[model samples]
Target: MGEQQNPFRTGGIARGHRFADREREVARIGQGLREAGGKLLVYGPRRMGKTSAIARALDLEQARGGTVARADLSTLSSLADMADVVLREVTRAVAAGKGFDDFLAEILKRVNIGFSVKQDASTGVPIPQVDVSMRSKPLEEQKLAVGEVFDAIDGMAAEHGIVIGLVLDEFQEIHRFEENFSEWNLRHIIEQHENVGYVLAGSKRSLIDRMLEADGAFYRMFDKLTVGPIAEDYLVPWMEERLAPLGDGAGEASERIVALAGERTHDRMRLARHTWFRAQQAGRSGRGAVDHAFAGLVEEDADEFLRQWVHLTVPQQNVLRAVSMKVKGLSTADTLQRFALKNSPTAVQAAQVLVERELLFQRPGEKGYFFDNPYFEAWVRERTAIDLGMEPPE
Candidate 1:
């Protein structure tokens, strides 16, 4: 097998052998997409592979004779942009498996917006291209254009017997597009559609919670699903198997990689990929190799870490240092003195700010906060070890 490349995929969507766990989640999403009028809200912390799982589910739905479309809301600037994405992707998905002439006859007639057909470069198939002129319109006009796009799709789905699934990844970004009315307006438009299953995926838990609050526009509109870490039992062995193709000591090294990388899927895979590279250089996948690889990563990101560090206040830096060191009772007299925090109130305020900046996060119903990036935590410990009179992390 032409020298297997790095099996640990850290970039883009993890697919094929690179993807691990989340079988149940994928199945649930596929089932939701297959049914008519299914609404689901899938969310998780950043880098948790929620997007990857959703993509896999969409692929499966498409294979099972369902029309599926996915668009990342984070990439768009306005509702009109979103409407264009939906119009292009939905039409592409619907027309992909059907006869070109049939799609033009059935779908094009229902769509009221102006668009043109562009031929695919490789497949030679025709692709629907939305008119860019819509972008120049007023925000209100753009909103109506978006609503019209969805209205047309809903009409098409009802007229033709078809199961359609629409996935809006990073759906919470709509708040930035039209803060005052976008949420309720979208909810209203979606409620009228009876044939398209909708899956809204997001990473920011704070904004998602606000949207689902009692007084919020999207309250109880979706069935909630939160993706968490893959089980270590599955992950470690999977990592070991992936690493085994590279060199020796895969078992122990995979364990260390997962432990050091913490629970996030992308983070773990990124470290694992680097660890594989280290193994290639050192001729073995061992604990020492993993540690060396991690230190290299810390060093590589040192400048960016320093930039983030310099932006915080002194007390915020101290609180971060404390959190990095895993110090308990951060506000206790001894802990504050050890970390050089000003006072209990000061430390509390600083930590809150760190959480707001996403430099730190506390698990739900959990007492203490944690570094969102474990590698950054390592950098902090290494940089402050001498002053703090502690040994640098290995």
Candidate 2:
């Protein structure tokens, strides 16, 4: 098959993954790693494309001959898996020309994927690709010696004069480790090297921020780079190019697409892809196409959303209903009466659970709240009126 006649895409990491408009950030990461040998933190909520941006930035440095490896610690079920994965990724990237088997004994673990030698046909130099996938074995399932994992990576960076980038995606999950390997220990290894740079990113904004606080282990250590949603201008034009062939309905379809997605990078792309697919299949465009696309997303998520709703307690569902409807004065008596919630305390408790589960989040630096998953919130309002016994809005 030739190049895409279709440009809408929204699956996977930053490169091929619904990627757009982080030129300034990409440049910042590259410059920090290159000039300052910076310990940088690229963090944001989920699906904001931190992984892709970091991967792209590291690729740029690699183009300039930097040896960079991205180890997604998120893929591991047990904390023990992380140390081994990182050691393997770093060693494989700087392996010079050796294969995964060469270091299997050294790392004392085996992964399904191979990191064997490959030579560039043109330059004859090795370009190590990230071999690990998201598959995880339980902690009780496997264990490995982590003692030399960090040290081996750091030594390789120093020994090879290679600039190594440790892009630890989902850095907050380190707290979930069974053995309680604290962040301070990781910070210690990171601090020892000038040649190695680290990009720590995660979705839980509050938790990740705690890791970087003044009294924290990584205090004053990293240059904080916030990765937020892509600008509207950047997203719209790229979307238009893909939707252009759809004709008269394309403009409305595109506008509806972005409007529903609400500055979320993944949602914008996924919705556009859905809209395009819907329009193509129906041989039509415009409001109908957009609505069908919207319906399709809600429908695809119906079971999951229902499961989520069922799992919530009565108060949580009520509070979620209020939040979904964009209720004002959340803590006030009127709000309590309007939602038939027990009281302000009940509302507060329910909201906290929703936030922890990432159903809702406070708008960054704002007092107002917003749904982390907007489609699910919309679904709640559409599907729950009769079930919840709430009268339909006027």
In order, candidate lDDTs are: 0.83, 0.69
lDDT for 334 (candidate 1): 88
What is the number of backbone collisions in each predicted candidate, taken in the order shown?
A: 0, 1
RMSD of every candidate to native, in Å, equals 2.1, 5.5
TM-score of each: 0.94, 0.83
Query: How far off is model 2, as Cα RMSD?
Result: 5.5
> Which tens-of-lDDT digit does each residue in 1-394 have in candidate 1?
2455888887799988888989999998887776688888898999999999998998777776678889888888777788888877786778654412355455577666677788877667566766788777778887887888888777787778776788988988888876534678889989878888888899888888888899977798878888999999999999898888667789999999989998899889988999988887777998888998888889999999999989889899889888888877789998798888888999999999999898899899988889999889998888965677876544
lDDT of 2 by residue, 1-394 (tens): 2233446666776464445779998997777666425688877788777877887887787777666677777866665567556765665565543223244344334332233444556555443332333125444333323434655555555555556666777777777763645577667656776766777777878776777898887788888889888877777776776677765577777777878776577777778888877666665657778877887898899999999899999888888778777777678787788778888888898888888888888875677567887678778888874565776452
Give the number of the best model, judged by lDDT. 1
Model 2: residues >4 Å from true position, as ranges?
A: 1-5, 14-18, 35-37, 95-147, 386-394
Model 1 scores a TM of 0.94
